[model samples]
Target chain A: MSIADNIETESDIGLSRTGKQREFAGSLAMPHDYFVLLKPRVMSLVVFTAFVGLIMAPGNIHPFIALVAISAIAVGAGAAGALNMWYDADIDAIMSRTSNRPIPAGIVAPVSALTFGIFMAFMSVMILGVLVNWLSASLLAFTIFFYVIVYSHWLKRSTPQNIVIGGAAGAFPPVIGWVAVTNSIGIESIILFAIIFVWTPPHFWSLALFRSDDYKKAGIPMMPIVAGNRSTQNQIFGYSIALAIVGVLPWVLGFGGITYAMVSVVFGMAFVYFAFGVLRMSPSDDEMKPAKKLFVFSIIYLFALFATLLGEALWTILL
Target chain B: MDNIVIKVTRVEDERIELNDKQKKARRARNIAIALLLGLLVVVFYFVTVLKFGPVVLERTL
Candidate 1:
């Protein structure tokens, strides 16, 4: 039977329905299904960081071109997210945290999600290449491939270091944005890339700290699943220290100003302090309150640093 | 005489009637696709204009 046979109303996506529906009636897929398929939250982060990268570059680009570049990157990121959801649908259905995702929730069928993902990925890359620089286009293409093929299909199931490596795919956006502006890659942009790359492990590990059961049940080899809580806690602390130092680099390297430096340093210290809390918390603590606190603050820390850079860039442009 | 039964393809077997919600969902998706296509055209036009600049208008016919 088609997945639609299984879909009860919107409110009740009944558990009675099979979790992973490989084949389904395409017409049953809703607009909201496709929207969530894009993983809007992740897309927003990609778009925001990319916009900052484009804005901070030492060159001028017409506003229209800039918009196209950022839109393409956003679409590309969305396409990758869709592919990830498609592949992970099986595991996602088992995990409470991911159970509501489009594929797992049966809002969208796996084949439909895959088709939409591939089509969007092709369009985003081709359009970006035709209208913008090929360098940026290639990076966009690579990011999608890396996220889908390397991370989702392979490392995610095979290794505990999945997020650590998969994190690189997310890190590419700022560099792609910078390249879109300058038509070249530079160290300054690499530092921007470093901020996201180093920030990902701890941020995800903190979430995994609390959601370890979910990952364990899903059979995904997340760090906390393979490594004991104490080890994962230690690693989170180490990455936090690294993120704090790297977070301040833009200011030290002269790309960021005093405002950027101040924001990064303050948030960076706070991030490390939160990680230390995670590190010191008793492993058996059922609440995982320290890990949860770190998880929430890590998001704020990244946003504060990037927001400061974005604000500085806008200020320079205006004044 | 016993008659042979035919098997349908998986997708055909999976065909579902579009309930009101499903129909509405499909309609919404169609509208979104149309809008995005229009946006794409606008983006391409603007990008071309920006890239070619005054040279396009200045070119000899």
Candidate 2:
């Protein structure tokens, strides 16, 4: 339900601009504010992962269909993000990191955002189902449902493992992309899903370490707030080990070539090293450098792993 | 559009006119929506053509 799905992009969705307005007389909301509701940064990652999954799947697809598929997937993710902002407006206002989000900033009304989210969600899923395959569309729908219902609405406040579970919503893009191409699931796409899924807890827990105050203020049960910093650090370390193992699975399973193997092992080690840094943090340090480092590096780590996979696949295809 | 535009009806009523900021914001949003709609039209056309080929337009009434 949150990862910032809790990583970044507290960016939320907006009115079609033609819709009814009330928050401000004449509705001062800019189109950009509406666009922010879509969570563009998060959408970028979803698009990239889904694009890679589509490309890596074992089939040829019409380029237009693939384009539509990716667009739909991205829009669907955005729709979910909009719903998240709509649902989390109260807490969002409390958290400094998210307070300026369009809804909280009074740039967009919550009902308008809700309307925009529902409309886009319906449109994206229907377009994908019609232009692409039902399987992918179903996956997209489920991703939105899981994020909006399971994560944002339910788990986000109820449990420390909110992201551990909600991360599935983020991980589904690639699988949806792969299914958009194959019209079926495959272990390769599953591996891509696994990488993101396993990568999420540590990625977010690092953020939770520093932003615990925000969560505390908002009453969101992020790992650090719920489980305590020490337990969260240990869990991050444990997940780091799991992440390293899972990161290398593509290579182990042989879909990834030597280049991917190298990227995975190197970045994977760096990930663990960072996590271990967080694990070894001292109370004397005024700032949580290790957690911050791990947080920043984790974004790079996931991107590098996925990029290598995308690059290797493209290389294989082009050559 | 001004934030508060006075529309002279038979009764001389005033319609809401956006301020400078709202006018610019509305213009920007309209342009964005127009662009997205234009893109959607193009995408749907291509998808129809690609999916159905030359036969896309061959349907009977």
- Tens digit of lDDT per residue, candidate 1, span A117-225? 9999999999989999999999999999999999999899999899999999999999999999999999988999999999999999999999999999999888877
lDDT of 1 at A239: 96
Q: Residues A179-296, candidate 2, lDDT per residue (tens digit)? A: 9989999999999999999999999998988888889999998987777888998999999999999999999999999999999999999999999999999633458999999999
The segments of candidate 1 whose C-alpha lies over 4 angstroms from its true place after superposition are A1-26, B1-17, B58-61
Highest DockQ, which number?
Answer: 1
Per-residue error for A229 in candidate 2, Å, reads 0.7
> Which pairs of residues collide in candidate 1?
none
| lDDT, model 2, position B29 | 76
